[model samples]
Target: MTLLESIKEPQDLRTLSPPEVGELAAEIRTFLVRAVTRTGGHLGPNLGVVELTIALHRVFDSPVDHILWDTGHQSYVHKLLTGRQDFSGLRGKGGLSGYPSRAESAHDVIENSHASTVLGWADGLAKADEVLGRRRHLVAVIGDGALTGGMAWEALNNIAAAGNRPLIIVVNDNERSYAPTIGGLAEHLATLRTTDGYERFLTWGKGVLQQTPVIGQPLYGSLHGAKKGFKDTFAPQGMFEDLGLKYLGPVDGHDTAAVESALHRAKRFHGPVLVHCITEKGRGCLPALADDADRFHTVGRMNPLTCEPLVVPAAASWTSVFGDEMAEIGAERPDVVAITAAMLQPVGLTRFAEEFPDRIWDVGIAEQHAAVSAAGLATGGLHPVVAVYATFLNRAFDQVLMDVALHGCGVTFVLDRAGVTGVDGPSHNGVWDMSVLQVVPGLRIAAPRDADRLREELREAVDVDDAPTVIRFPKEPVGEPIPAVGTIGGMDVLHRAPDPDVLLVAVGALAPLCLQTADLLAGAGIRCTVVDPRWVKPLDEQLPVLAAQHGLVAVVEDNSRAGGVGWAVGQALRDAGVDVPLRSFGVPERFLAHAGRGDVLAEIGLTPVEIAGRVSAVLERRAAAGERIRPKENGA
Candidate 1:
């Protein structure tokens, strides 16, 4: 068996010699490339962290000494070392999670895959350890890209002040998160990387000072106490030192021995310490290493040998539709600017950035800053489009409400992956945006049904000069255009049966599903009229009136059923005293597990068959109740 196969748990790693450990790293990389190619996960990041993860497991005993991964995309090696090596179903329904999961192992902590959160978790864990009088260490492995987040700095400030806490902050300097990390922190890290003055001083000072007999011990002690000041004069990693934390290395992250050595020193220190390790993203794989574009950070299922996608390409996705339109919008309005939270390519802003380089801004992983800055940009006489994943937008909600919505700034929030982003698991799903944003008064939300509407509504969203507007779409490829047979107010009527008994309200990409559902109902001799309310937030005034005509109204959306379009429509109908029986269909409140989007939808009863059956059952119940209530003509 190979060294990798021999390591069933972290403890198994201890049995291996130094040479075997190095061999283990090589084997793990090869295994990851082969396994991940089949399932398609965060390949480049995992490739970069093989040695780092091995060193971490070797240095710290997990479940006892907490080893937390920031962002968690780089935790595949960590998973392997912790005896969770099965990668056949990675990111799939019954498979291993792409990020750390407490359910998977006792070693995994903090399942939230959002960036820059590990430091805060580390600080809290360290505080608990100190309070409990435990000697167990807290090590947070955070990427340099994560350091760009403001929360990382906030945690650093708190960690620094707690000088008695033994915490090891491992900065995995890969120089990229999605795209090259932006902002001042990235620049500071770049500056710190170039200077080897600290390492050189430690090596030279130890040898020369030890040579002097009796004075050597005392002099070295004095110099060690004054090491921060001496190091500040040379390496200038004083950023951490100034904050009352010990700064260790610019260690080569790919070198298992070097990383372990740095980790060892940090673990020995009494107080908080920061170890900066430099590693190339996509270290082992030639294709990944050669990739200049975000280092192939996240990949789809691909050929193991060539890295070419196995699946046939579909039509333009919702993101691509937005990107193409944003470029045209940029050309028409020079004042239109775009902002991304360090995900230019993923969110489809790459084309816009290429077309109008000066108009685009990548604000690192700071969603809060992106919203607030967009508000600032709007006030400065420019229309700002803040493009981000719907899940990530949750971070900026307060900013969007306080800075943009309250102040009445014209900022368009283009939310890609707005609903049921299946494979990434619960944390990555964008289903909660509609429910959460319900409280933001005056914030208009548009859920486009097709690529045509996505383009049209995006223009409308940006045109609003006073309030914040949101345009949200799903992760799936843009479906064939569902044409409106008629329009009532802002709602597009997609299907209408003569003598309609049911009014079907379709939200966003669920239009096709609603159309299919209407067909099923019609096949059963139940007349159904389907309408797509392109804008979901503000219930179209005509909706209540239209609902009154039908015996029952069913609202379908990809968002949560709690406070989504269905709830809004029901409330509107109630206030208008329409008294129509209403049924809401959407994702349940519980967190959905990793699965295919179609499977999840079917499981949640969002399928046309399920929806039709439910509607038929409801109608049958209503008809039976009607017969019991009404006096039969000659029944006496």
Candidate 2:
């Protein structure tokens, strides 16, 4: 059997010889490339860490010595070695997650599929171990790119202050972050890789000292003892050392045995040690390595015939629509510039970046910085449209509230993936955008139900130079437009019947489901009207008047039930004293696992049948209270 097949756990790795372990690293890389190609996952990052992962597993007794992956995207090989080798249905509705999942393995401590924040977790875990008097090692494998985030620095500061805390930090320098990582850290890593001073010193000193007579062994031991200082002088490993942590290597991360030896030595150190391992992103894959862009960071299912991503018959997503419209608007308006938080392609800003290369900025994986920076850009008299994933925007809440909203910056925040990102898990769900943004005083929020409205409203958002505007949409593509819809104060009435008994207030992508529910209610002897409220915030003045016309109103949204649009609508009706009974329906406050968007929606009672049932119950109660009711006869 192959060495990979033999490794069921970390203990299995301890059994293999150095050369055998090297062979196993190659085998693991082969398996990862094949499996990820088929599964269409974070290929480049995982491929880059194959040897580093193998060496880590070989050196540490995991579960005892907890090894946390900073951004869990690079844990595929770690997963494979930990007995989840089967790639069947990987990243499917019920399969393995694209990132490290705590449900999948005990080895995975953090569930962040997103970038950065691992250093903080390592610091916290290490402190806990010390406080509890536990002897287990805490090792965090972080990327050089992750160092860009402010949170990572905060954690590094604490880890440094602890001074001799049993923490081993592995800086996996892959030379890329979605795009070759920006800023000072990337440059420093590049310098470390090119110099190769540490490696040369080790080799030259070993040869020279051994040839010397009498006290040569003693002299070499003394030299090796002060290796940290030597490395500090020759190579400016001063970054880690200045932070009060030991620094080792710009080691060849591709060599499993070399990495294993380095890891074993670092494990013996009491203080925090950063072992810099240099490896290529998309190491084994030629196509990904050569690509100038994201290098297949995430991909969809491939066409069997063409080997390209499988294309389907669907309307353009709200993100792409916004990008296209933004580029067009930007060309006309010189003041309009675009910014992304290391998610240009993911948020469909690639076209914008390509068209206006100088006008667009990609601030690496730092959401808070992105928001604050956009505020500065706005203050400088530029209309900056900050495009970020809805979930990721939560990271910049402080900046959004304090810098942008408080200052009334004219920056437009385009929140792509605003609701129900299916497979990326709870961390990625944009469900909280409506709930979270409600707290921002001057922030104007708009949700688009279809592609055309997304384009139009995005332009409108950019034109509004008075206050900041946030345009949000789901992960799925925009469905067919409701041609009969009418708009007023950001709300769109999709269908309205004269003398309607129930008013179906729909938000964003829930418009289609509400339409279906309206149809089902009509067949069951009820004439229902459906309205797509495009702007969920600043509850339209027409909404309370519309509620007065109906005896029952059911608000359907794809956000959390707690502070979602549905709740806001009900509250607005209550404040207006419309006297109409209101029922709000939306996703409950909980973390849902990997599932298809439709299945997840259904599970949360956002289906047509469930919505219709809710509307019927509200009407029944209203009738019992002597309120006027619509005809019980069939309306269809």
Candidate 3:
């Protein structure tokens, strides 16, 4: 068996000699490229942390001693070190998750994919350890890109204050989060960040002291204490030291011996210590290193040799549709600008940024700052479009509501990946945007069914110069445009039977599924009509009137059923005094597991067959109840 295969647990790493550790690191990188390329995952980040992970396992005892990986993508290497060698089904149904999972192993403390959260988790775990009088060590591995977030600093502040806590914070400074890190971490930390001086000094001291007599040990300890003056010369590690946590090194992350030495020093410290290790993303992988660093950060299934995608997307993505239109809008309207939370390329703002460099702001991974800054831009007479992932927007809900909506700032929030994104698991899914944003007064929401509607609705959202407007779309490819045979208010009527028994209200990407459900209902002797309500919030006045025309109403959405657009439609019908029986079809209130989009949707019973059957059952129940149906019976 190979060196990597021999490492079934963290303890197995201690068995490797110095040369064997180097061999194992190479084997792990080679295995990652082949396995991850076939399955598709965070390739670049994992490649960068090979030696760092091997060193971490050898230094710390995980599960007993808590070790947390920030932004969970970094945990893949940690996963490999801890007995999960199967990469055949990574991020697929009944397979391993892309991020860390509590269910997957005892070592995975933080499961959420959201960046900059590991530090907070570590802080809480450390506090618990101190309170319980346990002497377990807590190690939180955070990226430099994640440091740009406010939460990281907040946790750091708390961690720094606890000088008695035994914690090791390993900052894997690959100098990236998604893209090259923005803001001012490297400038102030210039001297210490890129050098091996500290590590070299430690190595020299250890070698000489162990070879010498009893006096050599005292001499080394005195030299170590006095070495603080040398580090203070240029504030090399002054940034972390000023925070009260003991700072260790800017060690070469690729050098297993150097990283292990630094980690060993940190492990010995009684108080909190921050070990800064410098590494490169996509290290040792030529194809991955040559590719755009961000693209390689998270890849779909692709050829490992040429770094080419295995299956080319037939249609444009929802993000690209928004990006293309934004470029045009930027050219037409000089007042139009954009903002993204460290996701310029992923959110499709690359074209907009290139075209209007002066008009866009690449705010570092701080979603709250992005929202508030957009509000400030709107207040200054510029129509700012805050583009971010749907799940990330949850961080800026307060700012969107208070700073934008309440203040009547014409800020448009373009939420990409706005529905069930199944592969990355529960934390990565963008299924809660519509539900949470529903409560914001004066805010309007639009869920486009196709690229045409996305373009149309994007323009509409930007034109709203009073209240905040949100236009959300899914991560899936933009499929063929479903043309409207008729228009009722701002809604698109896709299908209509001669005498409709049920009015199927489709929200956003679920439009096609609603049409299929209508067809299934028609075959079952139940005539159905399907409509895509372009603007789900402050819904069209004609919606209640149209609902009154049908015997039953069912709203379908890709979001949670409790408070999604479905719930909004139900409230609208109630306000209009239309007493039609209604059933809302959507994702039930629960965290979906890692799987394909189709599998998760089917699991939640959001398919056409399941929806049609439920509607038929509801109709039969209503018929059985006859005129004896009790008043105020909520079909939902």
**In terms of TM-score, which candidate is strongest?**
1
User: Candidate 3, after superposition: displacement of residue 175 in Å?
Assistant: 1.2
Of the two candidates 2 and 3, the one with more favorable TM-score, higher being better, is 3
lDDT of 3 by residue, 322-439 (tens): 9999999999999999999888999999999999999999778899999899989988999999999999999988988888888999999999988899999999889899899999
> Candidate 1's residue-wise lDDT over 1-636, tens digit each?
777877888988877788888888899989988999998899999999888898898888987888999999889999999898789999988899999998899998889799999999999988887778888888999999998889999999999988978999999998999888778878888878887766687778889998989999789889889877876776678877889989888898988899989999998999999999998999988999788888879998999899999986578888889999999999999989999998999999988999899999999999999999999999999999999999999998899999999999999999999889888889998998998898898999999999999999999998998999999999998979999999999899999877788899999999999999999999998888899988888878999988877888999999999998889999999999988888999999999998888878988999999999999999899788763311122131
Off by over 4 Å in 2: 201-234, 303-307, 311-313, 488-490, 621-627, 630-636
Candidate that scores best on lDDT: 1
Clashing pairs in 1: none
Cα error, candidate 3, residue 93 (Å):
0.7
Give the per-residue lDDT of model 2 (tens digit) for 1-636: 877887888888888887887788788767776676676677788888888988898788887889898878888898888888888667667788767888888988888866788888888888888889999878898887888888988998999998879799999987777878877777777777776866677788888997899877788889998876776566777877899988778788999878988888898998899899998887767677777687767756654234366656367777777878888898899999999877678788888888889998878889999899999999999999999989889998999999999998998999888888777778888889889999889788888878887887788888877678999988887778766456655567788766688888888777888899989998877777788767778888889987777767788888888888877887888898776777889878999876777878878888999989878877778679986775333131
TM-score of each: 0.96, 0.93, 0.94
Give, for candidate 1, the lowest lDDT window spanning 10 residues: 627-636
lDDT of 2 at 444: 85
Superposed Cα deviation of residue 348, candidate 3 (Å): 0.2
Model 1: CA > 4 A from native:
205-230, 627-636
Q: What order do you get sorting by TM-score, best first? A: 1, 3, 2
How high is the CA lDDT of each candidate model? 0.90, 0.82, 0.88
Candidate 3: pairs in clash: none
Question: Candidate 2 — which pairs collide?
Answer: none
